[model samples]
Target: MMRFDNIIIGMALSLILCGVTIGAERFPPPDFVETDHVIPSPTVPGPRQDIYEYIDAVVLLAALGLSSYLVLRRRSRRAIFVLMVFSLLYFGFWRKGCVCSVGAVQNIVLSIFDRDYTVPITVAVFFLLPLVFALFFGRVFCAAVCPLGAIQDLVLLRPISVPNWLESGLRLFAYVYLAAAVLFAATGSAFVICRYDPFVAFFRLSGNLNILIIGACLLVISVFIGRPYCRFICPYGVLLRQLSRLSKWRVTITPDECIQCRLCEDSCPFGAIKKPTTDWPTTEYSRSKKRLAILILLLPVLMFLCGWASSGLKTVTSRMHATVRLAERIYLEDTGKVEGTTDASLAFRATGKEQKELYADASNIRAEFKLGGWFFGGFVGLVIGLKLIAVSVWRKRTDYEAGRAGCLACGRCFQYCPKEHERLKKIKEARAKY
Candidate 1:
C-alpha cells in the first residue's frame, strides 16, 4: 500500500512536469510589459493572454488540485514536493525573467503615481485569487500556489532557528507591508508590493539591473533562510495571515488522528507550528484574547495611516507624473501625423505646452488618495471586527490550535508528522518482514 502510494505521487509529479515542459515549449518565456495597462499588440500572441497568466493558471490549478487531494485524502506528501519542483521549473527555468505577482505589486504601486496605470488582469488574478483561496483555505495558495514563496521554500534545506523576537518582528513587518500595498492599490497610486519583488528577475530571467540584483540577493538569502518572502515581506501573505487567523478550519499537524509522536516539530522547516500549549491554558487563552483586543483597536489607525501615507497628494503627484508624461509622449509620437518628420516631431512634441495642467487635470491622484484612506479605514475595521467575533465564538483551545495565518499549506509539516510517518514506517516494515 505504501509503495503504491509513493508510486502514485511520483507518477503525478511526472505528469505535472511533462505538462509544464509542453506548455513552456509552446508559449516560451513571457516578455515583461513596462506599463500597467495592456500594451496594444497588433499581432496577438497565441491563446494565452500573457505569459504570467498562461503559466500561473496551470501552476495554480495543478498545485491547488494536488494539494487539496493530498490534504483531503490524508495521503503521502511527495505530491507537495512535486508541485514545488514544477513551480521552480516554470518560474525559474521555463518562464525566466517575466513579470509576475512580484512585478504586479510593483506595477500596482507605480500605478498609484501614474493615472494611466491600470492593473493587468493576469497580474490582478495572481495577487487576488490566492487571497480569495486564503479566505477559506488558510494560506493554501502561499504554500502550493505562490511561485515566489514556493521557490524560497524549496531552497531552504538547511534549518536555522529563528529568534522569537525576530520572527515576531518579521511577522509584524509583513502586516505593515500588506497595509501599505492595499492602501496603494486602493488609491490607484501603485503596486508597491510587486515593485520590490526579489524573485521577479529570477522568474522572468530579465528586468532592471537593480531589480535583478535584488532578485539575486533574495535567491541567495533563501538558501540560508526559509521563505523570507512569506516571513518578512509579501503584502498579500500578510492579508492571508489575518484571514487565516479568523478562518473556521485550517491545516493541522494532525487531522483525523494523532499519535503525538512530536515528529512534526522536528520536520517543520518554517517554525510556524506552536506545540499546543496544554499547561497554563487559561493564561494563553487570556493572552490571545488580550492581543486580539489590542489588534482590533490598532488596525483601524494603522490602516488609515498607511492609506494616507501611500496615497498622499505629494507622494502620488511626484511618483505618477513622470510615468504619465512618458506614456503620453509615447502616445503622441506614435499617433502624430508627420511625413519623414519623426525626429523633428518628437523633439518638437517633447517640449510640450500646458503639459502640467493637462497631466494634473487628466489624473485623479488627490481624489484616489482620499478614497483609499476611507476604504482602508473601513476594511481594516471590518477585518478586526470579524476576528474578534470569531475568537469569541471558538473560544476553545482546540478551535484556535489549527495553524497560523498564511500557512502556505505546503504540507512541509506532514513530513514530520509522527503519526503519518510511523504508519508509513510500519507498513514498510511489515511488507519487508512478510
Candidate 2:
C-alpha cells in the first residue's frame, strides 16, 4: 500500500507537472518570469502576508512558541495542543514552502547569484530568532519552532543510539560545513548554507530533483534514527547546541526525585539521558583532568587566532572551484563535444562579448561563497561563544535540555510519553479492580 506521503507526493507532482505544461503552453518563459514590480501581486484573504507562505512560517513558530510557553509555565492548554498538531501539518507541509527557513536558505543563495537581490526578511528571521530565544529561553527554539526538525521528531518510532564517538564525529561535519559556508558567504561568493540545504525542497514542495531526493533520505532516516539531520548535519543545530550549553535553565533529571527508578532515562527516545556513572568520583575527576589538560594546551593558540582567523580567509576557494566547473562545462558544450549534442546547443554558442561577460561573471561565484561561509561561521561562533561564557558563570546544566539545538516542536511527546502511558495503564488497572 502506498504511504499517505507517497500518495500526497504523487498527486502533488502530477498537479505541478500538469500546471507547468499548461503554463508553458500558455504563458511562455518570458511571461512566467516577473519583470516589473507591478503592484506586488494581490493576496487573498486569510493570515497577513502571502497566505501559504505566512501560514507555514507562522504555524511552526506559533506552535513552538506557545507549546513551549505552556509546558514551561506548567499549564496544559489542550486546545492549543491540538492546534499545534493541525497547524504543523496544515501550515508547515501541506501549504507548501514559502518563507520556511529551509527555503529561505535558497533565497540567500539566489541573492549571491543576482547582485540586485536584497536580503530577505525570512532568511534573517531564521538565522536570528533562535539566537534571541537562546539568550533568554534556552533553546526553546529547538523545542518547537523548526519545521524540518519537527517533522523528523514526529516520525521517530524506534531509535537506536549510535556510539558517542560516532555521534560526535558526525557532529563535527556540521561545524566544518558551517565554517565552509561562513567562509563562502563572507567572501561574497554565495550562500552555501542555502544551496545544499537538505530540507528546502520539502519545504518548498518544489526544488531541484537532487534536493528532493536528499529530503526523502532525511525523512527515511528520521523514522529509524530520530532526527539525524538535526543531531548530525544541521549547521543551525550547531549554533543552538552552543547556546544551550550556557542556557540558564536546562531540562534536568531533577535531583529531588522520589526514586532513581531510571524511568525517565528509558522514556527518553533521543538518548538525552545519562545515568550517573557507577564510578562517579573517578569518572568526574578523570574527565575534569582531561578537559583541563586539553584547555591548557589549546587555549593560548585559540586566543591568538580566534579573532583574526574567524574573520579572514581572503582567498576564495569553494567559489573558485564552482567557477572552474561551470567554465569547463560551458567550454565542453560549446565545442560540440557534449554528448547527445543537438540543436539545443545553439543558444550557448559563445560570442566574444558573451565570453567576456561570463569571465566577469566569475565574481558571482566568489560572492556566493563569501556570503554562505561568513554567515554560517560568525553566526555559529557568536552563539556558541555566548553559551560558553554563560556556562562559565552558571555551572548548571542538563543533558535533557533538548540536545543543545534539537527540539523540533513536534507533539510527539504528547503521543509517546512513557510516563503518561504508564499512568494511563495504572488508572485502567485500578478501574478494573474497583
Candidate 3:
C-alpha cells in the first residue's frame, strides 16, 4: 500500500511540475518600453486583486486542511513532502510571498492600535488560520503548509544537532523579536519584521543587496542548521509553539506501546524528541525546590531592573519612530546646530507646521515608547523566570515522547519506529490475503 501511494504521489507531482513549466512557457514575459529620464509609477491593484486575495485565503485554508490530514491521519511523510513542494511553488514563488502570516503580525498590531489602519481580510485569515489550527492540531502548518519552513526544509541536507543550552538561548531571540515588532507597530513606527525579513527577497526575486545577501547566508546555514528561521527567528513561530503545547492532538513516535528500542532517539534533526527520565533523589529534589522558591521570590526584582534598564534606552528606541527622528533633525536644522537641512527637514519646513507642535508630537511618541519598553522588558524577565522555574521542576516520562512545545510535527520520526515498520508489514500481508 505504501509503495502504491508513493508511485501515485510521484506521478502526480511530476504532472503538476510539467504543467506549470508548460504554462510558464506559454505566457512569455511582457515587454516594457522605457522612456528617457522617466520614473515609472507603482501599479495599483484593482477589484480583481481583492478577489485574488480571497482566493489565496481559501487556498491557504485548503492547504492547511490537507496538511493536517496528511500528518495526523495518513502519517505519510512523502505526502507531506509533496505538499510542501506545492506550497513552496504556489505560496512562495507564484504569489511572491505577499500576505504572509509572519509579516501579518505587524499588520494586526497596527490595525488594533491605529484606528485608521485597516487590515485586509486575507491578511487577517493568514494571521489567524495557522494559530487556530495549532490550537487543535499542533504545528501541522509548520510541517508542510508554511512556505518559509518548506523552503528551508527542502535545503536541509546535513542537520547538526545544536546543544540544548545553546538552542534554548538562541530561541530567546524569537521572543525578543516578537516583542520589538509589536512595540514598533503599535507606536506607529516602522515594521521592523517586514523590513528585515531575509527570505522575502528570494520569494520576490528582487530586493536590496544587503537583504539578498542575508537570504543567501541563511540558505547556506540551512544546509546544516535545519530551519534556522523557524527555530530561532520567526515571530509567528513563538505563538505557534505556545499554542501547540495545549493542542488536543499531537504526533506520536509510535502508533502503539513503546518497546524501549530507542530507534527514534536520533531521528529528529531539530532535537525535539525527549527521552525517558528517572525520578530524582529526595535530596536533589529538595535542593531544586529551594532554588525554585528563591527564583520565584527574585522574579519581581528582575522585572523592575529589566524595566528600568529598558526605560533608560528610550532615546534609542524612540528613534524607531519617524516623527521623533524628524523632530530631532528639524530642531538641529532650526537652531543652527547642524550644517544644512535634510530632505525631511525641508519637507517639514515646507509644510508650515510649527516646530513646537512637532516637538509635542515627538514627545508623546517617546512617552509611548517608554511605557512599551517597560512592558517589553517585563515580558522578557517573565520568560526568563519561567524558564528557570521550568528547569528546576521535573516531569515524569516512562517512554519516548515528542516535546509538546518544541515539536514541529514534521513526521520524520515515524519512519524510525520498528513498530511502524511492523504495522506496515502487517498491512501488506492483509492486502495480499485479500
Per-residue lDDT of model 3, residues 1-434, tens digit only: 37898887886787686776433454454565773455568998655557888999999999999988988887878999999999989999999787798899999999999999999899999999999999999998899988889889999999899988788889989998999999999999989988998987899999988998998999999999889999998999999999999999988889788898999999888989999998776779778888999999988888888788787788899999999999999888878999988899888887889999999999999999999999888888877777777878888889998898888888899999999888878889999999
| Deviation in Å, model 2, residue 178 alpha carbon | 2.2
Candidate 1, lDDT over the whole model? 0.62
Q: How well does candidate 2 score on lDDT at residue 424?
A: 53
Error of 1 at 170 (Å): 1.7
lDDT of 2 by residue, 245-285 (tens): 67665443332232444445554555555444343355466
Q: Candidate 1, residue 27: CA error in Å?
A: 42
Best-to-worst ranking by lDDT: 3, 1, 2
User: By TM-score, how accurate is candidate 3?
Assistant: 0.88
lDDT of each: 0.62, 0.55, 0.89
Residue lDDT tens for model 1, 1-434: 37898887886787686776433453444676875665476986676456646666667566666656665455556776676677667765676624454455556565565688787766676656656666666776666656777778878878676774577656656655665676666555555655667776677667778988877787787787778877777776766777878765568766547655656655555667665444446656777777777777776676566556544544344344344444455446557632344453355455674545645643555555556555654554445455444544333243212356635677767666656667778779999998
**TM-scores vs. true structure, each candidate:** 0.64, 0.60, 0.88
For residue 247, give model 1's deviation from the true position in Å: 5.0
Compared with the true structure, model 1 gives a TM-score of 0.64
- Model 1 poorest 10 in a row by lDDT: 393-402
